[model samples]
Target: MKKLCSVMAGCAVLAMLPLTAFAYPIDVQKQLNGLSIDYNSYDTDNDIASIQVNNYGSTDAICRVVFNNGPESPRTRTIEVPAGKHKNATAKFTRTIIKMRINLTCTPK
Candidate 1:
């Protein structure tokens, strides 16, 4: 019985781990990290929250965004932006753009 309980506990912990992991292209990640990002503008047309991500660097870049509006108010998820010199993205919530975090995890090319 003790062995079974230990195994169950291990399984419970593993189940609690996040299973939603997105793997973007490696070459794109390298390109994105090499460039710098510039905040352009935000748009909220037709109840959709969208923002522009511009790469001010000399090369292209890849980036991901995470929206954090409020606790239990808007459940946002991680979304990858377009792989290019510049792109636009829409978040789950648009009421407050400050809560959004842009993660630029790019490797130097």
Candidate 2:
């Protein structure tokens, strides 16, 4: 009876392990679109901005970010991340245009 109970308990623990180990899916779309930039105080000589994105998914994801109304030409880049986690990227420019906006796209495999 004791051995049987021990074996059953072990099996139960093993089943629960997979459930807890599962990782959430990365939602890059929401992070990219939800980004907000504040330009309340305007200065002609100096302008700075930053953006961050977090990835939560079962697998790694690639992110492509684009910045519009930046001081320089528009920029795009891709990043890779692992499962059950998140990563962030930043963009900076000296020039500030009215209603600055950033667009991001994430792809997971």
Candidate 3:
């Protein structure tokens, strides 16, 4: 019975492995070509903060965003913008901060 319980638990853990997104391989830089992606604007009003990207090209765009503030450690993300559409990547701080700088580059993979 103990052996059966351990086997069942192991199987259950393996069964749920597919729920993780990092389980597979991903290539980032090669995926950013043939599209228009830019940091259009940013707004940090109230408790909310977001970075917006616009894609004007016929194809979708993927970009890597690096956000930095003097006091806090820098953060980054891989953002996807649909063709002719835009997207916003967001972040939150424990308390209100002064300023945040946004930088973006093409995504590969």
RMSD of each: 13.0, 17.3, 12.9
lDDT of candidate model 2 versus the reference: 0.49
Error of 1 at 33 (Å): 5.6
63-88 per-residue lDDT for model 1 (tens digits): 55543334425433333343345566
Tens-place lDDT digits, model 2, residues 4-92: 99999999998887443222221122343322221112222223333454555455666676655534776565666565555555545
Error (Å) of candidate 1 at residue 109 is 6.6
Q: Which scores better on lDDT, 1 or 2?
A: 2
Candidate 2 deviant stretches above 4 angstroms: 1-46
**Residue 62 error, candidate 3, Å:** 1.1
Instruction: Give the lDDT ranking, best first.
Output: 3, 2, 1
As for TM-score, the candidate ahead, 1 or 2, is 2
On lDDT, the candidate that comes out on top is 3
Task: Please state the error at residue 19 of candidate 3 in Å.
Answer: 44
Off by over 4 Å in 1: 1-34, 43-47, 73-84, 93-109
User: By TM-score, who's the top model here?
Assistant: 3
- lDDT per model vs. reference: 0.46, 0.49, 0.61
